[model samples]
Target: MTESHPHPLFAHGTLLDPQVQAALFGRTVPTTPASLTGHTAGPLEIADGSRNLRREFGGTVEGAVLHLTERELAAADAHAGDDFARRRVLLGSGEPAWAHLDARPLRPAARIVIVGDSIAYGRCDPQGGWAAHLAAAHIASNETGHRVFNLAIPGSTLADVAAQTPPLLAPRHPDTLVVAAGINDSAELLAAPDTTRDNLSHLADRLTPLAATALRHNARMVVVGPAWLDETRLDDYEGLRFTTARALALRAALRAWCEDNHIDFIDLWEPLRDRPHLFVDGVHPTPDGHKELFRHLST
Candidate 1:
């Protein structure tokens, strides 16, 4: 006889926001409102690089798992848009269980971790997101002790990770480190051209060192490429063309750097180029976008 499987979800980032839930899933009916509890909420921090003030920090954050019907999930996905991150089924109690997440066979007890910025954190939308999906896809029944921890911050930059790598790598000693940056770099680059350039250069230089840190700890490093930007916020009244060109150039260069550094690169821009609605506000990936990322990673 086969065991029964409960719908599993792992919610993190802005998906923890009630308002986002309303936006993505629509107002839940009183009877259908899924009660969420047991998890403590707080401010999520980024250990590296620069930060966007208005776009970053200071918000109530929590984690949860939602058990919803396929129809509800479809409606939610439609609202989330295609560019948003993906979601997957998982144990709501944060405990490992037998289930196939993103098509991956996760054993009942495997340990996994995902690291990145606000996008990785699932900024808007309810129900834990793409990370959950990725966990689902990668988890295998034979791989017990499987767990996924998302360490994404809204305004974290490469500099943050560079500075805090040791401590970040020390505690849990994650099996995988997913580094997603560049937006904060975009904002900061415009703020101080020379300073930002030097800072980012320093960050690039430290990539090898940082990877070494992860390698010493026996962790595989996956560098997630930043998404393409049609919108650019610049300084000194710079035209959009210059900002766009520069940002794109940076993206290309960063991708190159990642390849040269031997880090697994998740190229998000290519698949999402035509999808603009997946962006929440010109920046920050929608739940749909993040879900796509999870799917991409799984593939």
Candidate 2:
């Protein structure tokens, strides 16, 4: 027999606030006084300089168990943001529940550099792209010692990123290098599929050296794949053709390369596929799209 668990969300911090609950779920959810045993909660510093709950062994953290629907649980996840990771734990009342814990470890502030194409450049969005949103969030948090640099150029390919990366390593060494390219690579896919695949391979080969250099310097490398394009509006832009199928191919190739190289990969294809309102020209994301991208990137 399979075990059945209740959809209980244990809140020890902001989730416990009635106002916050109203803001997040649009109404107050039913919550019961509860506590988690075998753990203690304390102040945990996040990238934004805000303090959240951090758990340690050998004590109990008092909180409440909220009854939420699956949709509400997702909302709770978004409310937790990138600062926390959600997991399942047993409450003192012997009920299984979800809890958000600090996601970042205590470490010195580090610099993050993003390199990519027009999407990463925040084109069509007044608030800039996802990179800009991330930077703004960090700035607002006043995360001292942390910095984000957006080195993305419009219409850039993977090869272009290879050229733009090395110059920053010497004077502006980043602790994390984010490469968010490949949508443009798929532009040629409709006409020249083999050539596009070859291009991906060549680009991966070219990036290997750069990835090696960054890894040698103790820097983490993250590769973000392409977002889904609107086929209806794809040909509208200066006769440039792109398809969702081709974008998926490129995303898969990029993911494979990242796996082979032992690097982190973020896929924007599926997340942005159904979000048509988030796109302005079907290629570049609107302000809302960029915000969505930032949410995915941060998490």
Best by lDDT: 2
Q: lDDT for each of the candidates?
A: 0.49, 0.70
lDDT tens digits, residue span 1-299, model 2? 11133368888766777787798788888889998764555567433233455333335778889888777787877767876756445677776666765544212125677888999998998888888988877655556656778888999888888877887765665656778887777776445435535465576765687686565433456778888777777864554577787778888898888767546677877668877887888888888888887887666
Candidate 1 regions with alpha-carbon error over 4 angstroms: 1-110, 139-143, 188-198, 232-243
Worst 10 residues of 2 by lDDT: 101-110
Candidate 2 matches the true fold with a TM-score of 0.61
C-alpha-based local distance difference test score of model 2: 0.70
Write the residue-wise lDDT of candidate 1 on 5-115 in tens digits: 333334444444556656655753112112122112323221111111110011221334544455545454454443232322112233421111111111211344555
Question: Where does model 2 exceed 4 Å of error?
Answer: 1-109, 189-198
